[model samples]
Target: MSLLTHSRQRTAPSNTPPSRGGGRRTGRRAGAARKQFTAWLFLVPTLLVFGLFAWWPIVRSLLLGFQRTNLVDPAVWVGLDNFRALLDDPLLGTAVGNTLLFVGLGILIGFPAPLVLAAVVTTVRRGAGIYRFLVYLPVVIPPVVAILLWKWFYDPGSGLFNNALGLIGLGPFSWLESPDTAMLSLVLEATWAGMGGAVLIYLAAMAGIPAELYEAAEVDGAGIRRRIRHVMLPQLRSVIGLLLLVQLIGTIQVFTEPYVFTGGGPENATLTVLLLIFRYAFQDGEYGQAAALSFLMVLALALLSAVYLRATRSWSRS
Candidate 1:
């Protein structure tokens, strides 16, 4: 060895701890920190946007629930007065009952319609793209515009539906003018406009299912119906459960179709909770009452969602 190297080795300290992989680990942690910082930096704008537009409305609604404000004057604190007003209104019960009926009908029929439609669509071999396009086309139309178009179809005189039924000797019926038929009519319109979204989602999920599974079922002598029963439905259970929850929440908030179609008319048969809130806020300018109702609706939905989630936790796992 060189005399200088030998002199350096002799003078080197013996107390330094030898690092096994400390340098590598430190580099990794620093790199991870940098990556995390970069990710947060990119996400800040989106988070801020959601906070301003989405979360802010909810926070404002809660605050306004306790105060009366019409945006033209200073807000006045009314505490529980707005809620008490809602409680005393006789129409409030009608609206709630109608809303509950809507949700129940959707659960009974609307929830399964899309699933059945998607399954049927999958079985179509010719012009599949055209079929999907047709199935999803209604959703592309603005709901207000669609409701207006449907109003013509629902006309009591010379209407398409009644005209068709007339050919079969089914007497002309007032679809929207009668209280008994009005809610059903709204439900029908809602199902037509809404089922398209669920159908598309189900189609996407169906596409992800393994073809080999179906082939195996066929090899085991499973027919089409049996295959759907044992394989398709099982694969779709989680998606179905999720859509059911969404439908229940959405049906409770049914507003636009009822508003545009009947204006909550025919003795307020189509009146729903949201329409009542709209009337309070815009028609009567009772902002406090509207906010109070909105909060109550939110609370009811939240409780329902909690119960539904608890009930379906096992369903999801399966």
Candidate 2:
């Protein structure tokens, strides 16, 4: 009896491999690999589409920058000559100056206006949604429609602005006719059309701010102005910085407003880099120069974004 019992206990838990356990583990690994393969298979179409459409065009543009092409003849390698020609162009300085001025005016007049509007709209108890809708309505309007409407308002002879000013004893003034006022007019239209998006973004950001922070500031005898300065602005610094960067990039690439309104008109007073690029390609038929300018602009934007991120590391998302 004792010998049989001892033999049975020893055989019950021997070191022999459990085939079922090993099979389970192998099955688990096989399932995992199949799952991974399926996931990647699904991703293949998207990757291929992006590579073909998005990435290929970018690579082609980079390559074409150093070569000359008119879509019919074989591309001829020109190796930086196009860039040099752009540098030597007399209108380059004018375009850059106009672009810089546009950016400056946007920062000063355009940026703060939306912030103020958002702040006021936030405080209103009644009809808040109506106010928000009104502010954002301009954003939904088609660009061409809005630009045409503003064109009528900017008409020097019988424009709404001139007619209104004349009633107040002011002379009818040319808003977009003169070179001096053309850039400003473009900015005015741009800011009006653009600020709605910023306002909505800010309002969304403001919604996320902790109510307790506002209450704490108020308990400390803070007025509305004080609360905004101390509590709201600090909370929004990151959003504001992000929007500033976006606006700067967009403003530098200003094309549509100037293109539609003036065609970089009144002696190229409102010409921007993008407009110049368009002219180079379509007007002058210098595709090489256009590609070169596009490449340089991309490099500049990259450098600017890097510097901006470094400088605003505290607020930026990198």
Candidate 3:
């Protein structure tokens, strides 16, 4: 009987305690779950605040595009009327053209100025920090304050520019008064104000470029111009491309200069897309139209970014 019972004990399944390792693994998994839950608990407030302020506003704006309301009154659903009205308005065309002109001017003048400045600064061994500080000084100034300072500098009568030009018998020209010069004046001030950031970015990018590439180019009989063309430009391509896109987007949405400097005057010469949107909402109380216009601008910007990225993908990869 004892022999038979021993055989049965060996053959039959017996209830065994879970291995210590299995218990430890379960405890570890529970601990990890608790840690993850704690992390999410900490993130909840930030997510709530972001949703309340940022995401809610975006969603509300999208809804507002389809409704007509002065924000005090009841919102009336208007469907596509707001969008249609935008297309019908003559001012839209003018605003678009002006925006395009600003962008073009920015590309031609503003885009290259910082690059040139950075390149020149890179060659200087002494007082380089002072030059950088001076270049970046305008950026630290408040936008309105900087614009105001430039306004004084651009004063038609006894202005700094005119006074300097008078010595050479050149220009006591209307810097911001005439339509022909008003947009250009805005561009000049904008470029000066914005170039600081771009210069710093370019300087940082230049610093990352290996000195060996330049040395190799020089070894291959590449002079200054050739070295820059074959060595520097190729290396900085990605940074240059990114900054170009950012500048393009910022210039398209320009408002402050035209608003403060000219108030879209000199026969609406400097009116930009953002300024026009402002006029619609605040001036005309056309909130729906403004929202519609804003929605369209968002779409256009998104499309532009997508297209630009798609087009530049190959260049970036290569």
Candidate 4:
């Protein structure tokens, strides 16, 4: 009888219904696993495509930087010889200096013009949309087309600029023909071409600023300039910093203007790093050197970006 009772007690526990919560928990775990599997199923193709197209090319380029190949002949392993050749090339210093000059000029002329234009447009009570449209029109225009249009405007003899200046007896200027004016001309066109997007960004940011801050400044006896200095400038500080960094990166890699307009001519005065890379790869058939130089430029830009981000990390948090 005692043995039978013990067996019955053990059997009684097994006979009890399974806890409802435990069943639900198992179902929920299965459901979560299915969802996770579905998510990964959808993500796999995108991952594969990105790896094949983007990551593969970057890896290939990195490998190419150390190899000498014309994409036809079998690649020869050159180790650091490509980099050594780049360092030995005198044109490298010229290209770097010219690129730096372009960046400096872009900062001086291109950076502030957008902010100023946005501020002026904000003052206009009517036709603000029309003003924005006009400002942004150039961005829609093809870059090559815009450069060609400016080429006509820069003509030394019968150009619009020369004609306009002739009325004031200012005489004709060699805008693209002379090395002195060539880079400045490129900068001007680039500024005009690119400022539209920046202007719109500034305008959007400005619209988000509370009017009460401006009103409080007015109440505190602040004039227009003072209000801008104290209120507006502080608000736009981060935006300004971001755009400045973007401009610096863009100008340093300038290629199209020098290539299309000057051909890095007038004694290679307008020659830039990117154009030099193009020359190395296409003109000189030194593909390895071109890749090495491009890799170096990438490293430089990465370093610059890292430094800027590190410097701004604290300021951005505040």
Candidate 5:
């Protein structure tokens, strides 16, 4: 009887149910929910700030784009009349063209500069930090200071640029005087001032690249040029594309430099789209036209952003 009882006890399973595992899982889910709620609570203030300050203003401006208003009277519905006038305005066309030119020239001059500087820094064996600091120095300077310095440098008769050109027997060129050179001078100044940020970004990107890749390339008898072409360039393609898009958008809205330096003078050679919008709204008191122009600028930027997003999506898929 004792042997039979022992055998029966051995055959029976443990009393604890399998559902305990499910209970543990439920507990974990509850804990996760609590953490998530806490995180959201922390994010609420940031979201509220963005909504109130950034999003609300954007919404108001978009609504204002459709209405006509001034300091004295309340806004009235204008429908598409403002848009029609904007399209018909000869000055608008000129502003658009000049804005496009500024963006293009700025990118052409500015984009590669930082990349080159970053590449050089990466290759240097010594004093790289000093070089970076020197390059970044101008970026931290106030815009007013930078613009004033460039203005002094570009002075036709007594500027440093003219002096340097004279050493090589070149003419005392009127940089800001002529319409052709005015925009170019702006491009040069912008490039000089803006290259530091690009350099920093590119340097960071380069630092993220694995050293093993370069070491392997070196072991395979690859030279610097070959490695740059096959490895570095391919890795930087996405970064370069992103930077190009950002630069295009920023350059299109350029105002401060041109406003301070050129005042949209010399036959409006340096007048950007934003400057024209400002002149309309404040100087001329043409709020309708200004709103219309602002809306058009927004449309252009949206289109550019859309195209860039599509290209980025396609690249990611590939």
Candidate 6:
């Protein structure tokens, strides 16, 4: 009996309670519960709004995309008829082609303009703030005002563009009248209006880059071109990728500029995907087709975003 008692005393822990491990586990569970409650509390408003506005509407649109309705009668399920009709429509092809062209041209001209402007501004020692403000001014202008201003500027007889060309002995070209020039004119306007945002973003990104990198390059006997190529370009890769993706997504769905300026006229030269969707839904009362087109556009944007995200994964890892 004595030996057994001594063995028991030796095996028992002194510093901890018999239920200490279980108590610690229980405390951890309580803490986790509190954290979960706080998370839910923080998420309540966003979840409520998303469920009410975003998810509900998305589900309803999906259902409507497969049905036929005329604003009064019950929606009749028509299966894939709307999609089939859309596939067969000639204007669908035209809209797609025009949208791709518009996005391509917009990217060609608009994407690089901001980077160049930012670089130029960074190189300026005097009046940099004034130049930045002037460049950013158009971004704050109302879309209608900007479009009207461009319209006035593109006027064949009394426009600044025509006057400049005339000084070089060129004839006053009809900007919005000809199909060949109408889309180009719209693209030019979009480039001018949208460039400000890009410039600001690039400028911020460039400012984040350490000045020591340039100084180090100079110490190595590097000239301006070499410094920019080795120091600036590599540092700006992620920013350039992000801006390119954003520009591509936004330009693909361009509506206001073309709608207010050309009205998709001169043989539908300026008709974009969003404009086509607007015409179908509001003008032709084809909500189902318009919904389908909207869905396709969303899918395209998702794919582009995914590609860019993958390309910039290195930035996140770094």
Best by TM-score: 4
lDDT digits (tens) for residues 26-127 of candidate 4: 999999999999999999999999999999987888888999999999999999999999999999999999899899899999989999999999999999
Model 6 agreement with the true structure over 68-156: per-residue lDDT tens digits:
77556887888998889889989888888888998888888888888888989999899999999999999999989999999999999
After superposing candidate 3 on the true structure, give the runs of residues whose Cα lies further than 4 Å from its correct spot. Answer: 2-17
Kindly report which residue stretches of model 1 are placed more than 4 angstroms away from their true locations once superposed: 1-32, 219-221
Per-model RMSD to reference: 4.3, 3.9, 1.9, 1.5, 5.9, 3.6
lDDT of each: 0.93, 0.91, 0.94, 0.92, 0.87, 0.87
How do all models score by TM-score?
0.88, 0.91, 0.95, 0.96, 0.86, 0.89
In model 4, how many backbone clashes occur? 0
- TM value for model 1: 0.88
**What value does the lDDT take at residue 298 in candidate 2?**
92
**Native-to-model Cα distance after best TM-score fit, residue 57 in candidate 4, in Å:** 1.2
RMSD in Å for model 5:
5.9
Q: Could you give the candidate ranking by TM-score, starting with the highest? A: 4, 3, 2, 6, 1, 5
Model 5: how far residue 313 lies from native, Å: 3.6
The weakest ten consecutive residues by lDDT in model 6 span 63-72
**For each candidate, how many residue pairs have backbone atoms clashing (under 3 Å)?**
0, 0, 0, 0, 0, 0
lDDT of 1 at 274: 97
After superposition, the stretches of candidate 6 with alpha carbons farther than 4 Å from their true spots are 1-25, 311-318
**Ranking, lDDT, top scorer first:** 3, 1, 4, 2, 6, 5
Q: Name the candidate that leads on lDDT.
A: 3
Instruction: Locate the minimum summed-lDDT window of 10 residues in model 4.
Output: 10-19
